[model samples]
Target: MADPILSVRDLVTYFRPEEGVVRAVDGASFDLYPGGTLGIVGESGCGKSVTARSILRIVDRPGEVESGEILLRRDDGGIVDLAKIDPRRREMRAIRGGDIGYVFQEPMSSLSAFYTIGNQLMEAVRLHRAVTTKEARQRAVELLQLVGIPRPEQRVDAYSFELSGGLRQRVMIALALAAEPRILIADEPTTALDVTTQAQILDLIRRIQDERRLAVILITHDMGVIAEMADTVAVMYLGKVVESGPVDAIFHAPRHPYTQALLRSIPSVLAEPRSRLATIAGSIPHPYARPEGCPFHPRCARSIAGVCDRTVPVVTKLDERHEVRCVLYGRPAEAAE
Candidate 1:
């Protein structure tokens, strides 16, 4: 494969609360190649969303990216570490929409109620491109049409609340593409939508990706969605990625216990009617009370008592593209001793 468009390495994001520090994203790493989709899958609070926010430097208050290297390949054949840039700087602002677009989980909250949809999109257009108001409006309308919004010219003037859930999501997607970014970060893009609308939105994203050849980082808990959209898969447990590989390898032969449990929990179409679904043994450990050796030892069925709880497991490569963080693949004698 060609050089990756974006690379995240040893990312650690923490939130300081009254209780203690919450390590939302701990040492999570992945690479997104140009025109390829990387899916980050895990249950809630596993730091999938925080990983996206860390790349964009948009983590909310009290939360800070403690350490990470978010290396982005620039158009000029240079690499820039987005993690080092100040979030409030003009350069960062420009890069947010111009170089890397974001489609947030909730459109209603993401879109301002006070501004018209066209107005907001036009502002984004004008901010990135030095165009006149007329040109910006035209661009906004064009984007709305591009996202399959019906009668975009008229719909551009509509408020977010005036549009249905699917339409509102379309508008959000349009806004994300306002600057023609090289990479798109979608954090739970199909949340709160009906199954049909979710499928439509997913299809829209896939079509747009193929048409534009944009690198995408899709974050979701749904393995089915991951199967449908991702070329590579990263399975996160707590704030760390326990396994990462091609989507087929992760689905058909998951290495990590958590990944196996997650796949087992998904409902299968070929299963007998009304059969009980499989589930993980326990929930994710609390951030403050994180386990000593491995974060997943508490819930993992294959955890070795002294070995799993004694030393942290380093990543072990099963193949050129597949890796897992578990003692089972590590130095067994050392772990056992």
Candidate 2:
């Protein structure tokens, strides 16, 4: 079997606050194969953004990656442990934008207000490449065109405030691609845009991924977006990965009750009008008030006898690539008996 481009094993990220510690990412693990797209879906505060930040080792202060191994496949076929690598190391510096690009959720905040869009793109190119200023500017123009920016030369000199939301997002994509990274981590890149713009951005991401053979980590709460873009999906709840599998499996044959509930809640086109959307019974328990047994047991519709409450269920595999950390179907036979 071919090796994955990125593999995360038993990741745990916690935030220490005056209030208390919040386990933003607890024991989350997944793999990203070359040229693959992995979608992470969950509600806000479910650790979707933190998981992305943890992989890049940019967790904010008061938050620390307590444990885990993030293995990155190097060009020489070597595996580099990202967790152990120091933030100041030259290798990590090279890894951030050179190997992995990021498209942030809010284009307005992410882009500098003072700098022109062209200047940002040129700076990105110049940082990663040993090129003359003129050459870098040309590459920047090409990137804008590649991202479907209309009249790239004219938009190049525009400031963040001068561009529309969609145009700003395109510029963000253009900047992310400046280094020609192998992986793109898009953290809810389309959330703020209208429906039409959101579709355009999704289409743009697909085209870029196909063109570059990039590994994409798409983080969003919209299951519809995941169903459209993801080859595989991971469902996170209370910092833990409750279920993960092929998009089809998770969408059609979801094993965990949470996964089922989430899918049911998405408004369907074919369903009868006035049909109420199905909602999970209770809210996600607070980080400090996490339930003792299964964090999800309190809200799970299919809570099993003595399993969801007494013991934390282990992740059990339904097949080679599909697994769920729930008590229903993916539990040990001994426990099942």
Candidate 3:
């Protein structure tokens, strides 16, 4: 495999509230190769979106990347540590749209209600490219079509309220691609769409990735989405990744108890009638109230007697591409003595 286009190592993001610091993203690590789609799957409030926001340096004052490195490999082979770069720096600004694009969860929130879709898209292109308004508008229309929005020329003039949810999402994708970035971060892009629309959006993302060869980081909680689109998947729980491996490995034979619980919770079409889905017994540990040893032990069915309650387990690697942080991986012995 080629060197990763984006590498996140032990990223720790926290939010300072009146009640204490909330560890929104604690020691999350992953690498995404060029043109690879890495899915960060976790339930809501598990910090999937926080991780993405941290990568983009959009964490506000109350939240920050306290530690770790975000190394991005440039086209010229130079390594840029995104953690070190100020978000407002000219270099970082240039990189935001030029090398990395982001499609936020809510198109309505990211999109301007006051501005026309065409204007927004054209603005994104003009910010990155030194093109005339005419050229940028033309490019915006082309992108709208590429993202499957019909009547690109006409739709560009419409407001956010005028378009359907799916169409708005397509516009968001179009805007993200306006700069032709090398990496695209889709942060819950299909959340507002219906099932059929969600599938279409996922397909669009996959097609876009293949056609443009863009490295994609899909931030989603839907296991089905991860199974469908991800080459690699990271299962996050309470801001930390419990298991990360190839989609097939993690899906077929999950090593971590949390991973197993998550898989069991997914409703299956082929499941027996009247069968209740297997669910994790407890709710997610509060960010500030995370358990002493294993954060997930409180809810993990396979948790060990005393070890899981006593100390944090070290992340153990089962293979080059698979790892888990669980007491079941023999961390108990090391922590005990």
Candidate 4:
């Protein structure tokens, strides 16, 4: 396996609201290689988006990365800890859009209403690359064409409101690629799109990854999307990853109770006609009132009565490249003696 271009370990991001601390990302860890896709999946409020934002140091105020190592392998073959850097520093700002490109969930909200697509793309291009206005505009047209937008020459001048949802998404991709960054963090890029458009966007991402060997961090709640696009999968519950492994391992041989429940919940064509889809019993625990022990214990059918409700489960290795945080697989700390 290639050395990880990005590695996160024991990441803990907290939101200190007046009420309490929201542990948005607690002990989340993962690695992304140069040309592979890592899918982070969970229900809404499970911290998938927060994990991505934390990596780029773009978490909104009142929410800060409390502790962790965000290691980034730079172009010069040196390693830097992104978590330690001052996010407002020029170097960190350059790293934000220069080395890593982020495609947000909603194109309509992310793109400015007053600016043309060309203007937005040009801003991205010039910010990273020393290019004149005319050159940046030319690059914008090329980017639109690269992302498979129709009539790149004309659509370059169109505002976000002038385009369809699918087109707006394509423009978002163009803007993310405007800097030619090595890594792309796509947070629910297919949200609100029709199934057809969803497939197209996924395909475009795959094609671009193949062409550029770009590493991708795809954050979504859709397991089907993860199965289709991710090389590896990380199943997050509450704020921590409960299961992680190769996509095949996660889908065919999931170990954690939460992972199993998630896979079972996926609606399938092979299911009995008119049968109800399986659903996880309860909603994720509220961040302020998070349960002790395994965070998923309340909803996990397989949770042990006394053990899972009180003691936190440590990570247990299942096999090479596969791991889970559940007592079902992990030996107790004393048992290791």
Top candidate on TM-score is 4
Q: What is candidate 4's TM-score against the reference?
A: 0.98
TM-score of each: 0.97, 0.96, 0.97, 0.98
Summarize candidate 2's per-residue lDDT along 202-254 as a digit string, tens digits: 99999999999999999999999999999989999888888999999999899
Question: Worst ten-residue run, lDDT, model 3?
Answer: 328-337
**Candidate ordering by TM-score (highest first):** 4, 1, 3, 2
For each predicted model, how many residue pairs clash, with residues at least 3 apart or on different chains?
A: 0, 0, 1, 0
> How many clashing pairs does model 2 include?
0
Q: What are the root-mean-square deviations of the candidates from the true structure over C-alphas?
A: 1.5, 1.7, 1.3, 1.2
Instruction: Please list the residue runs of candidate 2 whose C-alpha ends up more than 4 Å from where it truly belongs after superposition.
Output: 330-337
CA displacement after TM-score superposition, residue 188 of candidate 3 (Å): 1.2
lDDT per residue for candidate 4 within 1-337, as digits (tens), equals 8789999999999999999899999999999999999999999999999999999999998999999999999988999999999989998989887889999999777899999989999999999999899999999999999999999999999999999999999999888888888999999999878999999999999999999989999999999999999999999988899999999999999999989999999999999999999999989777789998889999989888988887888899999999999988866564354
**Model 1: number of clashes?**
0
Write down the lDDT of every candidate, Cα atoms only. Answer: 0.92, 0.89, 0.90, 0.92
* Ranking, lDDT, top scorer first: 4, 1, 3, 2
The Cα error of candidate 2 at residue 300, in Å, is 0.8
Q: Candidate 3: list runs displaced more than 4 Å.
A: 332-337
Better of 1 and 3 by lDDT: 1
